[model samples]
Every structure is written in C-alpha cells, then in structure tokens.
Target: MTILLALDDTDSLESRGTGRLARAVADAIAKHYPIWGVTRHQLYVHPSIPYTSHNSCAVIHIDADGGEPLNTALSIAEKTMLDDFVEGSDPGLAGATLDQVAPAVIAFGRDAQQMVLTQERARTLAANLGIWLKGLGGTQDGVIGAMAGLGLAATRNDGRFLQKGTIRSLTGPTPAELLLGAGVDEIMTLDGRRVTEGTIILKEGKAAKACPINGRVVLFVDEQDGKLVAVKRN
Candidate 1:
C-alpha cells in the first residue's frame, strides 16, 4: 500500500510554512506506512515555479507566496494521482490543472484500498475548507510520531542536505533519473570514460584532439547553432 502526501496552497502565507509543516505531517504518516522513495519536480505557474515531489505513497507541493493558484495546482496533482490509481498506469497528468474537479479526485483517492495519504494532505485540505483533519482520520500528532520514529527532520537553513533518505547518489545509464533537480546539460565520454557535462560530445571515430590530464572531460557546444565548438578538459 502507498500513500501520496500532496501539498497545495490553501493555508495563508503566514501560516503555510512548507518545510516545517511538511516534516510534521510526514512524521505522522510514518506511523502507518514506510516511505520508500522521493522524487521532486518543478511546477511552472504563470510567473512562479514551485517545487513538488512524489514519495512512495504521498505527493508534496511547495511553493512561494502564492494562494489561489497554489491551491488549484495541488488539487490538480491529487486528481492526477487518483487517475493513475484508477487506470493502473503512470498517470500522465503531472503538469495539468484541474481545479474544478478536486473534490471528486479526493474522494477517489480516499476510496482506493491500496493508497493512503499522510495527515498533512488531509489536514491542509480540511483547513482550506474549514474542516478538521480528525474528521478525515488525519492529525498532526500522527505526523509528529512518524518523523520522530523515522528520524526525518526538517531541512536545515544551510544548503547542505537537500536530499532525504540514505540513498544519496545514483548509479546507472541514466544519471538524470537520480539528479532530477540538478540542471545537468548532458553526459559524454572522455578518455574512454563516461562523464556528465554541460554539453554533448560528438566524435568522428577519432580520439579527442585536446584531452585534460586532470579532472573530467566535457564537450562544449555552440549555443545558437548546436555545434560542437570545443572539448573542455576540466
């Protein structure tokens, strides 16, 4: 069973405190389920880009000081997840908006037997509608319990530890799958080795003309014409 803890903009700007509130809610959900993985994405609103993520059983949306649109976006995400459950596939509705159909989406997820939401998701929706989390079987105490037992603390102010969980690095052909938030341009081969760089490398069955003895190898390309301009050895 999995639960998707999704966040939307409903709480007032002064009270929305995402990181703190998210952590608190995550803590509570850990009591009933074990979170397996987390993936983050960027939501493009008219002028703002908010951060969002999907955990084993929850989805999280974090944004800046925006209100109505945030709520609308959250509703869309919830609906998307529910749609996936219904279809039994990767619901290709990640970036779509469905504000008018939010209530129906919530009801669907609630009825799914294999999925559950963290107290945070339930509480945020309830608060927006002047309802109570307890009425939905979601509560702050549950979140606190999950966080404490799982050792999932709120992210710190310093930009050191942005990722959660023990699996910190990636190993495979598509490194992009691991560093979804990192703006990596491309991956290339240097000295018969594969390395990630800011540009793609093109070769004509010949050794690289200029190779660096230290650091990594990267192929720099022309911005306008998309041509391989230089081979940079860093």
Candidate 2:
C-alpha cells in the first residue's frame, strides 16, 4: 500500500520552494517510514490564485509496509512543516492511502487544475472521505492545493518526480540499466519505444525527472547527436 502525503504553499517570495521543504520533510519521515519518492504537481496558474511563482504542490510517496503508524509520519511532516513556516504563506497538509481517494477527490483535483477552488470545499470533501487534512497556518488556502495534490497523485499519471532513489546523482551519459536501478520504472523514447539497453545522456547539474504514467515512472528521451538524451517534460 502507498500513502500519499501532500504539502502546498509553504514558501514566500524570499524563501525556498515547497519541493525543497518536501525533501526535508521526507528526510524526517524516512526515519520511520520508507519513502518511495516525491512528486511535484502543477496547479492552475490563473491570476486568481495566490502562488509564490508556479502554483504547485509536492507529494511524498511512502510505502505503508515500513512498519510505522500513519500518525507518526503525519506528526513528523507537520512538525517539519511548522518549523519552516514562512510568513504570509498559507500552508496546507493532506494525506491518505490510494484506496481512500474516491472519485469525488479525483474530480476535485482536476477541477483545481482548471478552475478556482475554495478551502471550504476541500475541507468538506476531505471530511466526507475521512482523509487526514489540515491547514497549518496563514489564510489556510493551502488546504485546497494539498488536498488536490493527493487526488492528482492518486491518479498515478500526473506530476513529475522531484526525487526518486539516486536519480538526482546521475549526470552525463548513463546506462539504461543504471537508470532502471535508480528507481526509474521504464526508459523509452518520446514515441513510446521501449529501451532495454543503451546509454541515455542527461543534462549536467540538473536533476532528472521521471514522469508518472499509468502508475509507473517513465523516463522519455529524444535522440540528439546520436545519443539518447532525457527529455524535460514538465
């Protein structure tokens, strides 16, 4: 079973991004729970939304078989988030197992990406679904994004991984087997051709992101200079 722990709107204009903070939270949770990866979900970028830069949220995938209670992981995440709370930032935290996310939650997530949503609606839906959700501080608008993140992540086809195993450490050209061993679920070309063995070129100083497609992490690449280079898909 996988637990989706989601966070949103926890940074100010002068502070670090939520993805970095999510990594810190994952570090704390890793003490008790096994972290599968962290994903970044982009929300609606309309003028009505109050966002630091890109309206996005971060979700940490945890394996429930790590032998720790959900509350323990939630406490660790809440404490970590509160400790780094930024002024003027409305932080929200939400979590649930994949099974707990119903169709309503998924609909809410899709709606958030296309239209403006309210904290009250998010809270109501969470309450009905029995999901663990809360607003840590400020306007509490982050609850909307946080709850939506859980739904989006539960779809298993949205967002790109912010961290997955040793993916961040891989640079330059790397073998396909090495990438698969580094927690990449699959490696293929942009046209959906599977790559079983080959060298894939990665950009220097940039963390490689594998997108979730049908519940698997897939690394899509494009051929350049006779070498397979990983494509940057938002």
Candidate 3:
C-alpha cells in the first residue's frame, strides 16, 4: 500500500527548514517501511500567508501494508514535529492512502499553487473526503498548506525530493551505476534525454535534488561548463 503524507509550516524564520524536518520523518518511517522520498511543493506565496520560508510544503510516499503501519508512521511524524518544531511555529500534517484520495482535493492543490487558499475550505473538503488532517500547534495555519501539499503530491508534477530515500546517499558527481543501484527510477537530462552507462552526473553536494514526474524519480540536468550539472530544486 502507498501512503501519502504532507507536512507544512513547522518552523519560524530562524528555525530548521520544513524540508529538513520532513526528511527526518521519512528517515524514521523508513526504519519500518520502504520510503520512496519526500517531495517539496511550492505553495502560493503572498503577504497574506504567514510562512516561515518559501511558503512551501513537503509530501512523503511510503510503501506500507496495512493501516497499523500507516498509523504508526503518522504517530512518528506527529510526535517528531511536536517535539522538534520551533517555538511559535504552526505545524500541520495531512496523510491518507494514496489510492483513496479524491480528485477534488488534488484540484485544490493545483489552485493553491496559483492562489491563496483558506483553512475553512480545506477542512471542509477533507471532511467530505474523509482524509486525515491535523494541526500540531500554534494557530494551526499549517493545515492549509499541508492539505494542498497532499493534493499536489498525488500528482506527478508538483515537487522535488528532499532525499532519494535510499540507504546510500548520492552526492557529488555520481555515476550512472550508483544512481541506478540506489533505486532511482530514471536518470535523465532536463530535456528528457536518458543518461547512459559510464556517464558522470555533476551534482553539487546537497543542492542536487530530484523531482517526481510521471510516476518516476527524475533528476533533471543541463549541459554546463562541459559537464552535466543537476538542475537544483527550487
């Protein structure tokens, strides 16, 4: 079974980034299940929205068999965020079975990318769809982005991975063999050309991140300075 989890607004300006916090949750859950990865979705950014950074949210995909592990994963994520989130920060977590999500919820996510959404609207939709949604602390405004992220994550075109969710981390100029061995679905340039064997992919430390597209883990790149440099996630 595939589980979808979205977390948002778990920090203040000086606190740890939500992407890092989401990575921690994915790491914890991977101890029991196969975590595909966490994806960072950019939400609508405006003065009306009180966001810590980038006005974004993160969604994680995991392979778990039953509701027990899913609940356990949710507990682990909520506890981690509650214990670890910065003071004065509002945090929210949205989770559901991927196969059971409603299409309307995903439409909301698409709208959120371009327009500001309200908490009342998200909660109403979640209520109708019976999706899992909760606010961890503060004013609980994080629920808005958390809900939107869940919808966006269900789509193939919304976000970038925080990590590859493999036991081995890919850093620096990685070879094609390493990427394939680490469970990467495909290695391709930004223009959709596949990387072949014996090719070197120039990645800059942690900045080099991959995005999920069309049900595949895709690392976009471009030719620069005579080397294939990864297009860092924004």
Q: Write the per-residue lDDT of candidate 3 for residues 1-234, one digit (tens) a residue.
A: 789889996579867878889988888888888887788998888888887658889988888754887789899899988878777889999888887578998999999889878889989988988888999988898998899988898986778777774613667787777766776677787777898665555554554467788878877778777787767655
The true-structure Cα RMSD of candidate 1 reads 18.2
Pairs of residues clashing in candidate 2: none
Residue-pair clashes per candidate, as listed? Answer: 13, 0, 0
The top-ranked prediction according to TM-score is 2
- Candidate no. 3 TM-score: 0.92
Prediction 1 global C-alpha lDDT: 0.29
lDDT of candidate 2 over 33-118, digit per residue (tens): 78989999989988878887789999999998422456788889999988888888899999888888899999999998999999
How well does candidate 1 score on lDDT at residue 123? 41
> Which of 2 and 3 is the better model by TM-score?
2
Q: Please give the RMSD to the true structure for each candidate, in Å.
A: 18.2, 1.7, 1.9
The 10 consecutive residues of candidate 1 with the worst lDDT sum are 150-159
Q: Give the lDDT of residue 76 in candidate 2.
A: 93
Model 2: CA > 4 A from native: 65-68
